[model samples]
Target: MLSKKERAEEDALVEEELQAMGPKGLLGMFSTKGAKKKPKLFLELSKAQQRVQGKNSLVLRQLDGDTMSDKLSTYKKTIRFHILAAHDEAITMVKELRGLRQDVNARDEKGRSALHFACRMGSEAAIATLIKEEGSVDEPDLEMRWTPLHYAVMGKHKYAAKLLLKYAPSPYVTVNRRDKIGTTPLMIAAAEGHASIVRFLLDSSADINDRDTYLISQGMTALHYAALTDQVKSVEVLLEYKAKVEIRTKASGETALELAERLGSHLVSVALFECK
Candidate 1:
């Protein structure tokens, strides 16, 4: 056993060594201060790691979003290109798009389908293809409520009109189908001076004297439209088909001849007068 003085001297030397070793020394292993500080440092490092991981995850998500948006944009542009190609009678390109799983019945903003464009462009071959592909023959547009047949007649496409009539699920329904203003295909044919189409419609069981029952042109027949538009040949055809010459419009109460005279349609007026 050492003397009290010797014990004091040894304790002093141990304190000096501990002070020099600092917090990371062997003495720190049993020190509560060092224990607390180590846990705090570890927590800070973990928080930094989590922040880096969060930033990386956010960047990955943003990249994915951008990639998806680009894909969607590309898809829309491709679809539009194929639709325009259909209008230009690019049947092969359309078929290719269809083969790639694109919707064949996709419509434009105005609800005009591929078949409608095909008819408006007078593409007989494209019309045939669309019909074979199960395109709706009597599909009506959202704007004018005009069917493919109506477009065919409006564009003076006789063959396209014939194809529509031939492929229509119901011939009678399609031939006499009316528009937004209650104007039937025959009425449009007459108004546009499409005499041959008028004759075709009449032969196809279109009501020759079917009247427009919609707004301004209410109670106006095919003959009335022909006469008002100065379509002499159409008027003659209507008369030959036994169109009512005396059928008066509900709005104006004018016969076909009277409407012709009022509209200054000299040729149509003569034809209606001769028929009367």
Candidate 2:
């Protein structure tokens, strides 16, 4: 074992190496004018370190007077910020830190998991890494009961969605697996007119007629959601899957065709009417 002075010197060297490999340095590798550009992730990483170190540890060491939990909360925030900002290197570093017992599962004030942030930023690689690390894909944020899949759809990130589906399938992929409006993955895809996703989900054996008790009545199906949104293609896809055309909502007591007509989606109305 090294003497106290030698150990201190070794620790100083390790800290210097870490700082050199940090976000600011990583940015320099991308942009020649990085110093002029001011990478926000560098600042976030600094905040994260302060958070991981905890104020209480500093106080206990007689170095400062801050609390441990407070510092940890701040670190969690920084981890989220880096994930949201699409800082791939930063995310890698954070995961490594978390693997070293830095608390990777920490949630932000919004209750969004890091996987949600990767989806929001359309970072497929980061998302893939998180999923491989067995990160929670089912966590909901503050709003929309939105999971990573919800963010992927809203952000229009096909690749990120694809990555998620590859690593973790829906229903099994999302927690409570329900949207804020109480819709499922198939329901959200239908409502948003995402025909491809609709088709994929249907092919994946997602229940074509799953209905949420909170938003609509028990009888409503994916076709009902599709027709309501005037998504003609979605309606056709559901119909092709043998979805019940005559399904009705408890609140509206209207068939898919009737709802389609009300929404002025003539194609969907016509298709539903033609359905057996």
Candidate 3:
């Protein structure tokens, strides 16, 4: 073992390296930024209609809408500031809007607010400014009952999620809150193979065995989804966090281990067997 001074020096080096990597750190490498990006998912719609939603199009003020006149709604234009991370513009407009005592959380046709757009953009500075302006942290869009935290995690915006967890009013209120589909942020992170997010949510005391209702009758836990989707690291982390291994699916009555076996996910199956 090194002396205390040497250990402190080593610790400082690690912290410096992380900060040098910017807001994303190690998780940045695994983010869905390029070809690895998957389809957009949120307050999920029917399977067929789900494809229509974009990863960032939470608002319904479409560019191609029939009423594409210059007189677009104020909220729609303001949301653009958040999406574009126009800090100076956002600050000026938001201050002006506040002076008029307007609703910062005003919803577009799809119930999305500027705050929602900020979260989707993963602009931590923009999100912090909006939250400081009294933006509602737990507001839901028409797409689903997803909170800003949900969007942050789903977008692989770890910095945004960190800010929300620290500053949002009662992180517990929305930390585990389920969407219309009963999917929690933890469940979404697992299915998408977001191992770092899985670790963060687990550390934040997210329910390790929380259940969700999918499109059909399947009542699945985070582990079930991880196993079914071949998220090997997610399976290991869930089991390590003491997630229930005995929980069975509501429809097929399959446990996570069984699901992994069925999908020929040998690595996940091996991890589950060790859990058993």
Which one is best on TM-score? Answer: 3
Better of 1 and 2 by TM-score: 1
Clashing pairs in 1: none
Q: Candidate 3 has what TM-score?
A: 0.70
lDDT of 2 by residue, 79-169 (tens): 4344443555446545565666433444543455667766766877677767776777776766467788877766667677777776675
Put down candidate 1 lDDT per residue, 71-160, tens digits, no spaces.
Answer: 222233333433443455566746655786445565543456667767876877778877877878888877689898988888888988
Error of 3 at 52 (Å): 20
Clashes of 2: 4
Q: What's the CA RMSD of model 2 in angstroms?
A: 9.6
- On residues 12-66, what C-alpha lDDT tens digit does candidate 3 reach at each position? 5544544554665421323356656554222123423432443244453443334
How accurate locally, in lDDT, is each candidate?
Answer: 0.70, 0.63, 0.69
Error of 2 at 109 (Å): 0.9
